[model samples]
Target: MSNEQENPLLQYIFNNPEEFARNLTKIAENSGKALAAYLEPRESGRVQDETPEELSLAVKTLAQVGEYWMKDPARAIEAQTRLWTGYMHVWNNTLKRMAGEDSAPTITPAPGDKRFRDAEWEENQFFDFVKQMYLQTTQWAEHLVEGATDVDEHTRHKAAFYVRQITNAMAPSNFILTNPELLRETMTSNGENLVKGMEMLAEDIKAGNGEVKLRQSDPSSFEIGKNVANTPGKVIAQNDVCQLIQYEPQTEQVYKRPILVVPPWINKYYILDLNEEKSFIRWMVEQGHTVFVISWVNPDERQSQKSFEHYMQEGIFMALDTIQKTTQQSTVNAIGYCVGGTLLAIALAYMAKTGQKDRVATVTFLTTQVDFVHSGDLRVFVDEEQIKLLEDRMNKQGYLDGSKMATAFNMLRSNDLIWPYVINNYIRGKEPFPFDLLFWNSDATRLPAANHSFYLRNCYLTNNLAKGELEIDGIKIDLKDVEIPVYNLATREDHIAPAISVLEGSHCFGGPVEYVLAGSGHIAGVVNPPHKNKYQYWTNDGLHRDINDWLNTAEEHPGSWWPHWQEWITDKDNTLVKARKPGARRVKILEDAPGSYVKVRL
Candidate 1:
């Protein structure tokens, strides 16, 4: 179990011969050349004047090359294989001359020392490489042997793409030339222009002034100031198992219609309460809306046996009960983000199926999907075999580690995250930029083993929820029965939740659905508020007439929809009860703010 004894490369090679041969070849070549030229120290050994400098330069150059190879390794190994074989031949002749009478230095590979084993593994991998080449060559030869026929353009293009994929996988190359032209043509004609427009928009965002703005007409500024003032203060409220920690809002400005905020248990709630400058929670409170967000308990190995049913009962349902009690309201509006949204949808479906529709007034979803068939790239992580492997690992560990979930997200955007760091630190000799978001992103949380298994099998792999075949607690839930007004936001450029996959699919909700195509990625789009030079929103319904009209006609808005949303929510505010602090008899009090469970990391 010690780090020193752990051989990642050995483990990988033993498990995957094809990958080992494809990777070990490069490591072998560099070590071979470096070891071959190392002369034995002697009094008459004439060292060159610039020998040290030459070695230093070679070492530095090879190190730089190593960083580049790490990103697209298949090709690097192939090149390294060729280099190593050449070095081995030269080294053999040198050994013969150096050891005429005396024996040469023993260079036995023990499959544990990185240097010796690396070369040895590469030598063994050559047979695998030859076998793979023969198999592929045979597959390609079959097409030629049958005599090439005139194939349709579509079929030919598809064949060519597969041919290229296989060739790239086997032959490997450091420089990968992508044909974006084909991808461009596949997108809608207007989409091509939209991409260019987005680039300009991104440039504008990068160039925009970050100066603070003042609004004389806004009554909400005082409320936001109050929330900001209490940054280090503790605010806690509880009912049974549901606990609410208000680091900001302590008083109750119970809007006639309250909105429940459901964020993913995988992440902290502070994404909504990020900071005063970009806090959506603060913004909502200032806009005269009562917001209740769920703070999830971070499960440890001890809590690994907890299932999806437990999460629904203890997390979402418990929070809902507390919200109803605190507001003294029969129904409340609901908003769910990411995985929380998916969970909320399941809860809502369950509620409707069991005739509990009076609890929710309206539903709002942010980047959540019910169907997974159209989910892109993420599918690579969940093949049947990989899923089985993941489940087995989770069961062994008692829970799916949070760090593992974080790694998956990072890999989804590896070009933007992992590769840039590798290039900067390893190649360009630069340190990483310190960003709060990246820090928060790296702080991963674990999923209980039982919960993770159910999530993958029921929601993702099966897509049973949207199909109306999903049952929870013996209740056959249907989304169609949950017909409250709905607001669904989808980011145009979200890879995690593609626009077409969610926004277009909202038609299946069978409700008064209002779909908004926001102008950013998953996180940025949701976090964005109405600000100068930020971005605008387009709706399936008409332009900024009214919430009702906007939900009815497809129209484009030129600016932030923050003010419009504020107007819509406040239109139904009550004058009966002012914002008040709840007494012990009226509302239950819990632990200090941010709670014990919110701070758990792993």
Candidate 2:
């Protein structure tokens, strides 16, 4: 064979040596400049001096895993043996492929694992071997963590989570050399991709003030009021904690009982109103239901002392009062998403204890958790040590930076959320397409110190709400007392609020509970509009203790939960009243919404 035929890379370089060298120089030049962006912050004292709190936690957690494994050398050695044997199989397979023989992969990516979805991962022998070996190593490490019986559950959970994050970061696809697509791009562009990537890295580091603010979507494409959260509403009431938005009526008549949607303060409410077609808020209004949503303020040091109770007082209570005055309705139907649902549950219990049970006639919880005993991996960060460290950090800023919470959430599904962005934005040198959901995701809100601290200690750490031990304003509130009708929705594939956790939490409600399971994660499952008819939900007349049992007997239905929810809520009282305008009676319109609160960027 000719020398050029022996190596395609050499042939390409031989054809365009000057271009190749220029690209290499560009890559080297930009690589050094990226560091300057990061270092500038340190020089100005903008970056903190101490070690990251998460790194410390990971080290401590991994130590426990090591301790457990070291106690049983035989088991540890066996795990190593399994890994080596797997590697040997991959080695033999790669050898066979090189010799022009067909060889099946030793291991493959798990179902729904998108990381290796690229065709090159399975089609190319070299990439296949690399993928299989990595999978085996990850599986072995996971099994080792699982076998660490001596390690406590909390330690084990942390170790497992930390390990996944590390493995994800170290994935073959993350690096240009191992990633076939990235490699092809680099060669074709003559290393220009790396230069562009480095420039982006520097800009991102500057954007995050020393941390990589991984851009998930083109932020320039969408504006809060212009495109997202544009469901035609007016902010009629305002408080320190939230802005009460009353959407304009789309139908001539609406249900007698208005729906007050209390979305989690952690995320902007636009997820439900990404656009007119997908907007749950728009659909609700179209279905002849008066809908009002709480737009939580992006808090700062001034709002640091805002406790959980204050959110209820200034958020839900204030909205409810506004709804009553506007429509002259005695009661309202309540909808709470995620943490907002938990707060609503607490508020309902408090109201019942204080003899104000008539204010909220019915309650619907979307991906909400009252009981946190099995709250999944989020509980790993709730222990005394981490919480104290977190509290101290929050104290310094008077509120936890929204980015920290955003990063923690992204960690839960790091492969889906984190690594993809890293590869696309940092390695491939590509800007992501405009995605509304991702834009809203990047728009994070600060958590007040007192509120966050109380929530962590009470709900996540102690499980007080489920135990009937949670107190509000010196009153011990019991969920058993707030026995109005309940519609509890849990998403099937939710990482933030697991279906099992939601099922377990249903036991806390004293009312006749109708538990429904929706397909997809926390956001998509709930925001699914009937128009799109994407995903499915399950309904069971009975609430079973085990989630599997509930699923086994449940009736599966196609389409969104919004229509199902509409049917359920309206079934209680379908009395038609003339649709009321924003700030109808007593209240005055503060401003047109997607309100100023929703527009506040951290």
Candidate 3:
């Protein structure tokens, strides 16, 4: 008992060995009595046979216990003690079950699960130690209940509450909270480190370069011509995200027909034209679609006065006006991504509500959500208190900081992007690898505090979008009122905008909604063109249907959904005409391919 004092449960088990042994004797006596009754059979045609070997074994067991039986007084005392101990064990176990807590199984103390003799030995020792401790504690608890001096209805209830409280106090959660070392290790591991290191690197780069890099116009990987800006037919349209260079045939000109690309102000529009290999915008240009992307101005403190109504008017509606005038086309195919998609949906709804849908011929939404309910975990950070705090902070600064927006995104993948780099670069003196995606991820945009707060509270927190209760510029917007041909793309692995949540948009839209499920997260899914490693999509029969029904018939395929999308768009427009420019009489060229608004710094 002294040696076992290090573990209280083990000490209890050791101190009660006699009582345990006595219980074994009692169980044996009960077994013998049952066997003797079985040996007696009523007079009938049926014969109950007892094996000689079994009868001999039972007789031998009874003979051994006969000595204890003769010492009746001592044996009776021991049996009573064992019964009390068993009762204690049952009571403790009942309390544990009610608490919904688990006693974790023992684990081997090694670097990994690799097996060796020492590992096996350690595993056995750990499990044995835990098992012994559990049995002793259970027995002690059971014994107390069985030996209660005053047992009545009220007393029993009081005892039960005490047992539960004791069980809870001794629960495993206490150990978890006290383990700071484990918490430190977990928070500092994996992708978290990369994000933190990338953040620092982004700051250094932004400080040195002043503005994020915009790739010069380039042709799609699938295009036959070179993507060089100086190339004969290399058409350049620069935005803050990147420079989209289009290579069209000498005969195929963009001065005739136009295609408008609308991206959310939250992110740069370059996702459509990330690079020649992966750029969807580049592919459309090569496929003879006159691509006109909206290069959103990166807002700053000066633009803090800009409101949601301004974004729709100056940002999207203005772009549409320019595209229409430049191309001399009455309507254009407008594709929006993320927040841009939400904006596009708003514009489409506005057009529908106003009894006007002619300017926009086709609309596509990439990972956009109309319903607030399925907005996923992004809702966590947009509660009333958080929104108010952000509004106050942003109002002071005029616009929400770009780096701050990036911080929120990195928090979503903290284990993958924040703390790991904090430990490696800040704590461990390690240099991070320069990854292109990380660089792109670090490039963020600013939003007006008033606008951002309104969006978070009205769209996400309140879910006014799907309810047809969303108001833009004092005008109630209803998506169902819109009769435009709509295309919605959702990614399966998008944590920011989950597929389940994004699908709500299809239901909210009154138009012919074609919802497609793409592969990968938000960015990769949309940027994925018809490349070898690209993923496939699932769609219904071009009719608006429930999400589950579409999934049931949806087969998984590989490569991007862009090709399928292009086919769908082409089918809507059967006539092939030369690409045209915005032919408005009074509109003047504002800037080069990419605009100045995208270049503003924090």
Candidate 4:
């Protein structure tokens, strides 16, 4: 008569007790491996203990906001009352909906919320109540943070960020008991999913050497050079910092100016060369460009002494020298993405200081920042308190582990990146589908101590580059001195480099800037190809204004901005030259395309 009895788990448990017991035993064994995977590294002293500052920073930041409410009794009581009111409404709605009144939800999930996609989160009374309660509780939490206005700007941002992390971890969708889809699967499989999931947990822990490296895609399904980054090219030259690869030309006659790509070292350059369909590098080659990309080395203790000056001198500048020799050209067009763009901007200033500004004829900055005034949430983790802690950790190994940066980026979009994997892989015991972008995302690279430290201190911490206070190799470089034509691109919904920050950087430049806005976030927006036509782009209506002002009068174009970029680049210099091979002129071919450097995995 009872629902539990009628829908009994493992309906034939009495007959299938043998298989059930075997699965339970497997789970127990796998759980032991996971524990051992975490402890063995510490026992052997292979991994050092990190400072407690990381944990304390979150606590202290939250305390600042808590102190705001504690100072006023009315504020504290009002927050509690607000929470209780929301709970009461959720309860009332649950009762009405249970009685078949079609009662509307007390609060709805945000537009793109994928958590409540299951019909049971709404059609079923119990699950619906749980979903509404979670939404209401999130609203209450948001109210508490918003009301703490007395908190300083940075501290408040950190508190709100911490709150979101805590709330995301507590979402009901993360647990099998609270998630309808997970619960149904658990019961249907008689808990075999839990056993397999435990096995996976142990594997990931072992792979990370005591940390959990959640598998975002089926790793077995993809390889870097074979599937994901398989573009036709050859490595022309290599140094300690990077290897320069020149793609085989797709067109008989290519643009005279060779394009050298300076990609961020935080992640692999394959993001721009994902696959045939999504390959931005391949697309550029097809657009009659002789594409050359610098594949930065994954750092180690050997590169501990490498600084920002060294990266400019060895990485970007070295690639520029090689590009000139390989293409037999005096000048080249340059493209810089993210942090790489920042370096190119610095190099431009340095070039101007040395009277060599014409080395790179025209430049393009893709989601790069010279000013950090409006730098997004990443700033919350870059304060003196945290950077000091980070430096201390880096001193132990000479390089910041790639995973540390990767984890921080994921935290920015925890609901989409972290929780979803926790549910699908750990709870549902299903492997995620093969996705090129996520595969590239998981492939992170280490950051050398000197380079990372100087960057954080100068750019993120001090905003020196914008103020002309940045000194490189004992030279005070100025952006205004290097007045070359620039094509500045910013993604509309970027979390790392916000459009406003990119817009502000446009003002810092002393040249004519052709600013364009693309729809989507950092990666997707930049990598979009014209044929795919996935997203739209906006160009200013021949007026120079701020982001908001420009958006109001911008000309919206359908599809990717690649075609427009091709047109813009060619108009500058449409002269055609015979397609150049990887090592036709001077630089000797060192290796095949994608290079040995990118094949080095973390």
The prediction achieving the highest lDDT against the true structure is 4
Clashing pairs for predicted structure model 4, backbone only: none
lDDT string, candidate 1, 392-456, tens digits: 77777677767567656765665455444433332222334654455456546778888778777
For each candidate, what is the lDDT?
0.55, 0.88, 0.58, 0.88
In candidate 3, stretches whose alpha carbon ends up further than 4 angstroms from where it belongs are 1-257, 427-430, 542-549, 581-587
In TM-score terms, candidate 2 sits at 0.96
List model 2 lDDT by residue over 269-350, tens digit each. 8888899777888988998989999999999999999999899999989988888899999799999999999999999999
TM-score of each: 0.60, 0.96, 0.61, 0.96
Model 1 CA deviation exceeding 4 Å by range: 1-243, 246-254, 426-429, 542-554, 571-576, 582-586
Model 4 misplacement above 4 A = 1-21, 542-545
Locate the minimum summed-lDDT window of 10 residues in model 3. 215-224
List model 4 lDDT by residue over 45-113, tens digit each: 897656466778888988888888888999888888899999999999988877778777899999999
Whose lDDT is higher: candidate 2's or candidate 3's? 2
Q: Which lDDT tens digits does candidate 3 get at residues 1-602?
A: 46535553332232344554554464455445434333333233232232354345434433334444335677556656765565455445444544654443222222431112222222233323433344455444444444443444333333433343344335221231222222233233422323333344444333423322221111122221222111222223333222332233333543344566777777666555555676676677777777766766677676787777777777667666555555567787888888778878888888877766888878888898877676765665565655776787788778887866776676565535554454345223246565435545655788876678778877887878778888887789888887778888899889888888777667887778787899889887887867656677777664334567668877776788888888888877856666443323554544444344444444
lDDT of 3 at 177: 24
RMSD of each: 20.4, 2.1, 23.9, 2.4
Displacement of the residue 569 alpha carbon in candidate 4, Å: 0.4
